[model samples]
Target: MTPYQRWTLRTDATSYTVRLSADGPWAELDAWGPHGVETGPSALDWSHRTHFFTPADAAPAEYLPYGLRPFTGADLVASRPGEERGVWWEFAGAEEDEGALRLAFTDEVLGLRTVLCYRTVPGTDVILRWTEFTSSRELRLERLDSAAVTVPVTGPARLTYLTGQWSQEFQHTRLDLSRGTFSMGSTQGAPGHAYAPWLAVQDGENGPAYGVALEWPGNWHLTAQAEPGGFVRVRAGRVPHEGAVYLTPGETLTTPRLACAFSAEGLDGLSRVWHRYERHLSGERLRRPRKVLYNSWEATAFDVDAAGQLELAKTAADIGAELFVVDDGWFTGRADDTGGLGDWYPDPAAFPDGFGRFVDDVRALGLDFGLWIEPEAVSPGSELYAEHPDWVYRIEDRPARLVRNQLLLDLGRTDVQDFVIGTLDRLLTEYDISYLKWDMNRPPTERSRPGAGPADRLDLDAQHVAGYLHVLDHLRSAHPHVTVEGCAGGGARVDHATLARTDVLWPSDNTAPLDRLAIQYGFLHAHAPHVMSSWVTDAPGVFDPRSRSLAFRFVNAMCGVLGIGADLRHWDADQRAEAARWIARYKDVRDVVHLGEARLLGSPRDVTCGVQYDGADGRTVVAALSTGPLDGAPLVPGRPARLRLRGLDAAATYRDADSGAAYSGAHLLHYGLPFAWSAAHDAELVVLTRE
Candidate 1:
């Protein structure tokens, strides 16, 4: 969606495919073709043809990031380099190593560039980041390491770890990247991880989904997918095969990275249907209006009453919360544990009047109505379960361990799919609900169906995962107007594919200020701030209990997605006032933060984390958060150090987060002042106004 004519960027770990078609009402740089690939314009005729599913085919048509595959004819067999199938998109511009190409598809429909090697031979790594802008932002491949990374996805089906020759897998095309130890060829048992046959990359009604038929060698998971800003990765082990594989020095493992520029859950799953979906995303960018909002569950407990919900909603609307989302606890039989899932109808006992009244009340306060749904989960204790106990998935003979007392519904099955789609479709039409938070609570486990052969080596993980993709796809198409927020045990399934559907995502369940400081730091490295959900919790000392200053909240809220989950209706006057104040402040600058460059001034390990935003007119906002007294000690006595900032307007005026006193960029940054927090003290957000 970042304005580009047509561009393809690929690396050892991933590839990017971007295209610009007819822009509505307005079009900026007109697209020509896949003109920027170094290898030449690839024959997209195959892409134009109805793609057939096979065990092997090495082309990069629906391949992510860029449409270029990592290797082709020459890459397959180093011995017969010239004999390798060569396809070109463009080859017009070149200077030996200059990154540009020409293409036969070089018409007015697309325009793209390619960055073939991340490590143009490892470490003297090549990059497209510093290139001259082509009316589009530059793309780059970065290497972020293992322990420093978190799982990426918005639901339960997520890969805890990943490794590779881990780049591209085009069905039976027999990918062999092995000149410098870059090859992916496994034997019968140790089948390498990959999307079998093909992966469907589609833009659904709400977001995007990379669908795979998922017949693979071994049980696997969708480990990670870091988009836009990109990610650093680790590889998974593959069974070695009989071949002269390539190696990059001592780097023994290899991997194919998931590409994105990604994330989404949609309201109606309209984007899932190929024809309508193609028409939906053929041309467009995500459109959003600024909104202040609040969510429950982060507030009070699961035992929320209509009164409790209404109390929170009142405070939410009063404090400018646009979409009042009542998180969890609305369905019949849903109390603490998820025993009564799939019962979408409201609990008539909880409120004599139904959710219609809840929607009406929220609307009365000038706010939109939002609800949460985990439609993919079915509990053994519910009426749906009593009617169809077999619908719950678990291996036969093995006691089904109650994961939150709920079982994952098989979206891959026709009857199950119909049931889920029916339940959600009815809700969309029945309620005037404007927003939904789609939660997936799936974990890695046995996915035994009613009659699927147990010894058939079914990739239950993959199939269950496929079911999730199907459910999300179906729902998004069903409700296009209802914005969804994806949550997977909090942060389990935070990835690029989910982002295309929903406007925001729950970054992690771990909201401890110190932990979140680093947790969110890594999340932002690959994702836009707007997709993240940030809020204040009981991080002692981050905010004075009676200060009425959401200093910590503003720091977390300002960066990406913003929300306060703690029960606000129970907060003291000061806490409530503080929350309200921070909410208002963000309303003033959300646009600037949402659309600016985010610069990390230091490593997340430091006692203090620094971030800066350089907006269009040179307006800069520098935010810093105190992690904690490093090594269990206080730093209150540390010197008032001056900070030399990056991405700052060296000439802009700066203001203190506390005093509002102004200082020139040169004066404040020149003197390195240590952060001013005691014990587990506060964090700060500073905005710089350029004159």
Candidate 2:
């Protein structure tokens, strides 16, 4: 391991070495596959090799620059009191933990102490990076960035990121990395749907691909700048939206964790590495087999009541739904999005006998019960809001701005935090609720507290997230049996911080099968499939007008945690029977589909796109969808060709679950399976078991 240098970090497949330069300190990356970390003598030292004409100590114009240097392109940016020039950090030394490396630096002039942290796990190729800042005297920092790493670029390079808006999340976009700064972030109080806090740069058409993802749930920023040399400096951290954090003497501020992953095998390889790291943290694939759930949101939005929910539960149970969730309109005065947010109590008129009988009825139908709750928001007309006027986020003199006719509950306050936890605790304790759909319908607005200015409100943003997580942690600890699904009006609050506490995530409010192909595709690139909860909702979709067959919808939703949000009562006998069969098939192969390695077969934007799931055992499942004209016309000239399966045992004999035809895995992989579906938006699911 390169003799275990004091200022070096190594993952299973990569090595990052740092050194003190005349201008500051910089890091160079070398990555290899499973063979091991590459620490050969030929490794280039970019710090002092003089990539530019300027001397390293003479105000670095090239070479590699860091927070410790006098450079404009610094990875870390900060300002302290009484500093005429920009603050420069000096390397003090380094320290090593069990699986982490820490490099310490200090700016004596500003009485600021900085430490950069890098960590790695055994099976992952990701290097986790973050920065810690401490001050001896009180100071205000304009900006504090997490650790930054310089990646070598060769030939042409491209930067790929995900972007979307409400109802349309996780749309992957790629742009070539240019000379200037390329950046994307969330200025909204929370991580907005416009962009996910992640970025990737692929250097050369065939060289290694490196990526970084911020683990913060609040507003975050990431920037990539191409330097004079063939290197790109990337930095990411929490965004200082209000500017200037007033740091107390003994109070230390740590930036959000920024994780970097490297793969010599390109974007797919890097994506898989990230997937493994996420799975390692979430236990996503190893957790109890995900249930076939039915959420009654699209079915009965604001009309949730006892008799209707009971009928829906019966229909859902008949179709093999293991969990029945009643979404929205369950609480007092909650007829729509405008009212009854903070009041967690059941509506006396809607549920005349309370939720006890409904819960029992659902449980009797052989399905687990779940309730949807939005703990972080309150309507202005809610009784809770009327009672606790100071609980919501509000400016001192300005009137509160309401989104969806609801104001954000200030979890930053201890009392507000207690109320949220207490209400959830009471629900779990009273009812037989196995799942809780924790939701945040709107982003925070008018976030300033009564006495705190805008700068101080920045602290509220961070604290609210912490408080949100604190409540989740307490819930998980107390109700160990209940599983939580995190939602922000569907997918806005998806990040490491939220994923760590929740069991599943709603990728988007838009569940149209055709659109979901692209949405789920982008989502699975970072998050594991098991943690993604996709539903087959009623269409004529809310977002798109493309009418898809139920079979196509089933396969799309089955790719993740299979769910149904369609109104079962409106379905005909044949449709219900077909749904029952599909649900049965999903349950039969869910082990492979939920816990196995996922492989995307084709681009979602193309005429044909599909996914392959390979289990540790000898089972494999392939779900393919045709987006082009399939009925009478061919997308191409002739009929579609066969689809070759992936990650199968080539020598083993396999049997098709439907046809019961036996074939060699080698033949299946070589000759490929026949593509039967020809109708537009038609999907096919094939399950193969080794014999």
Candidate 3:
């Protein structure tokens, strides 16, 4: 009754087709994107052709099979209970169910079965793939991949992916596709701060790009290999255990789903596909109004008390902040990082009369209250840790390693999970808290478990991620009104996995605007601006230290969700006035900047550059920043710094919100407006609304 089959799967912009070889097994399928041509059906005979299961002379044309296939890019590799040979899957059947197509393969010798599932969204060119395995007899799997896809392209293809370390995550890198295997993966318990589980492949710099992203949050791998016949194979999955998983009779396992998309419209277009998919899933929250919040870390440090906080709150409220977050050091015995973790209670010294009156006062001042918490760590000096030393990951004889003077609490334990959930629940229920900044400051190390064998230790990494998600999910469900921002010593845990649950991400701990520009630029490439919370902090930059103007800082921070981490109590009267003006300006265009599609023009390395946000309804805003000309190159004699505006109707006219200057869309897109810089480190925000 279904029109789709094993032969073809089609979308509005692309089509995928496969046909059976003479022996009834599928051949290498042909994929057609907007830029690629379609291929004819298979014509090979079974007379002398090699089968993947047979001891073959070449790699199987079908999706990478394990045994006799010469292909190294395999999706499934396993053996039976008493056998030494690899799995040899035989073609069973293919059928369509609802909106999905399933291809089943079986091995009577090993009594193992696999189903290759595929589905295409109704209007998009994305293809979703995953694998399911079932066994009639006990089987052992050494390697199992979630999905494997092959793309037809010759030499000169380039691969692009994101890589960085703590405080500097999401830096984009591109490398030419070489002959051998190039993989980006992490085995350090998490998707890790080093590499993100996403990649894009293209023939060259410009157009016709293919993108792939793995949905798993635990340790994972993605490999792209250049095959012999001008084709490339990509496979992604949870890191397969070299030690094996024994599946009992009647048992079944399903791998994580992989999402793939293709666009002939270049990298930006490919990015748009991902953006659309995320926005569709997030719905209203993706477009919700973000607040201008003031975080009190840089202002007060660990010397926190009710009276001091109240004073800072008054100044923050006076300057038009809608949210006030009291970052670390609000809890029990908390003089420094080494003492008060794991004990999640209001410090008696910091809040002598309890936090109730302070919360009421903050509410009376017309600002929502937020709190910072690192729920997954413990300090050895804390009362809670002293009470429950077994709650953290540790080995029998090894000294527990500490980073940031804290140990990772094994949330994988039910008792630890309950305690975390209970603490967060009580906090949210007892206070007028409107936001929570959930932070994890250190990576997983010393990953051994007491009384557990080696096999169980191998699973510790996955259990930690599972436990973290469970806590996050439970808290969000119980307290739907509160917004949660994710931070891991700043930006280490910023990925789609955490982004899906949290309302915002602290992009970095270093918010000095000059450094923030590049950090934010790299972040926006894979993440939307709405979830990237960039703050205007007082700290000097990591790289540049020329004392940038406050206006430049404000413009750069406004490119994402705006937060102020400055000590407002110390700001001069003139500084306070300028701050108020910029805050007002940000409020006016918050919708466009938060919900609109962002376009970064020129490189962040360029001296004069801009970030533009184009709203769906024809409104636009451009924040142009200049730190002198590029390499001190003199300005053109008659041409100003021209920015060719994008995403405007060529036939329409627009008026500037401030200057009331009129310009045709054609003129703006062609000749561009003359952006004049008065001095070094100068910045200006330009607003244009179509008429």
Candidate 4:
């Protein structure tokens, strides 16, 4: 008889434990929470309960197959070609190395071995979990989840997740689950704007929050089920194709990493845990400050020409922009979005005096040059598409569908991946470019590879994801100096995997002040500010029609990595001077805004909303805005709306940088920062130094 054995994985502030009971063959979660949670009695233990189903079905399993966990949903579902569909696996062995633990299980009848993997992230409350499957014989996996997390909730579970449409991405949503299941996912090839691959769960408003995020960039799903036996189980992983993914002999299939976090201080604290983990993912790249860039997409659109772009670059440089990007229309045949996507060379008609000369001219203005490229897409009218018609995805007998007048190149193919890599490499080599805006304007439509086999056709999503990642990996290694900004028609392909590769992410295309505030408010809950690339655009109103001042726009953009997308050529002397001043002010506080701990003050729903950043070096920066009409009567006759500060040294005193007024930290934390709104002073950028 195998005696009960347990293993504990710990981070600085949290602990996760797994145990194999002497009476059961599967591993189960013992405890998961604050640092000392493993020492207490597990709330998940179901050993004493009487059950009609198998013991493993009712237990808080780490990872169980369909046969053993027939009643409850299984983390893995597999079968042989002509055999039954379930895995009745037995315990094989266990291995532990430095902070990671691996538990192996084998189904001899199916000739398969499965290993559950766990490793605690250093200096964070996040534990990375995944599963590996190896088959001695060929097998089909209908469902292969990365990990199943058992939340320690005694009653109903409140789930907080992110969901929305394209321009309105990252809207926060909440649901309460007492029974049944709740699921969210994306089938749009990339992690679509409809739903993010993340979820946070807690028992009540004040309970500890448990969060999980999948590191997959392709089709994925996250499901939370409040079982009848009184516990919430969250299963997260990449969603397989129409049928199943084939696992041949000796070829191991490893699922994407699932990062699980526990925070006793609720969802806000859980966000900080995710932020630290993201910073760790960034490695040395986080050390470099995200530069202020001016993208010409909004200014000129497809009417891009060397002369016009040069004029914009001059104004951008004058306003203290560090990088100038030519967005779209630069390449040959691309007078508009319909014609020249695949042809990446600069248009001779637009440049007149060579693309190299144009790049040099932009750089001569003391700003680094950047270019936008949508490598995964090709216009039907493009030369590359006309040459390699077979490269784009299509069904043999069906008419090829075009989205945005373009077809998605079959990036899953090695030849297609090589072509993209070559295009980027050659462009980077020829031009003195320091930044690349990699954008995917649309998802793949009619996704199919004509000549592939029955089983191989289903693997298109995974293959494309692998191929996309390979291109990014090559870019990182080949051109380490170049900063890569990831965008998928704005924030569609955002995930841990993409975040690890790109320097920053463009959260949304709608830069209107109020709409962007709400979008960013939701975005900051799951992402770090450093990676959120926000722009100041001349969008009169994309979602909200309310007119906002230049200061309001600057303050809104200042909450993240700042950029200017508005046409600078049209700006008068006063507007340009104000913008230059705002740019200089942003440079002053960007370090604290990017590197500091971010706290979402009052939400966008509140009349007064803001974001506060507390730096490790004793500096605090806050970007406050009045979301509602300033002409409305005050809530209190004589009192100003206050944003109570958080994460401060209550004993110390903080002095305002603008007004030179000093206030005790206790008062700031309790009484909050005061703001009186008007048309001209609807937003404020406050820098506080602790004394």
Report the number of the highest-lDDT candidate.
4
Query: Where is model 1 more than 4 Å wrong at Cα?
Result: 1-257, 260-286, 453-462, 539-550, 628-638, 649-681
Ranking by TM-score: 4, 2, 3, 1
The lDDT of model 2 is 0.77
Model 1, residue 346: what's the lDDT?
A: 85
Tens digits of per-residue lDDT, candidate 4, 382-415, equal 8998899999988888899888889999899999
Model 2 TM-score?
A: 0.93
Per-model TM-score versus the true fold:
0.61, 0.93, 0.91, 0.98
Residue 396 in model 3: shift from native, Å?
A: 1.9
Query: Considering only N, C-alpha and C atoms within 3 Å, which residue pairs clash in candidate 3?
Result: none
Clash number for every model?
112, 1, 0, 0
- Name the top TM-score candidate: 4
| Model 2 root mean square deviation, Cα atoms | 3.1
* Residues 235-254, model 1: lDDT tens digits: 22221121222222222222
Query: Whole-model Cα lDDT per candidate?
Result: 0.47, 0.77, 0.76, 0.90
Question: Given candidate 3, what's the lDDT at residue 194?
Answer: 81
lDDT of 1: 0.47
Model 1 collision count: 112
Is candidate 2 or 4 superior in lDDT?
4
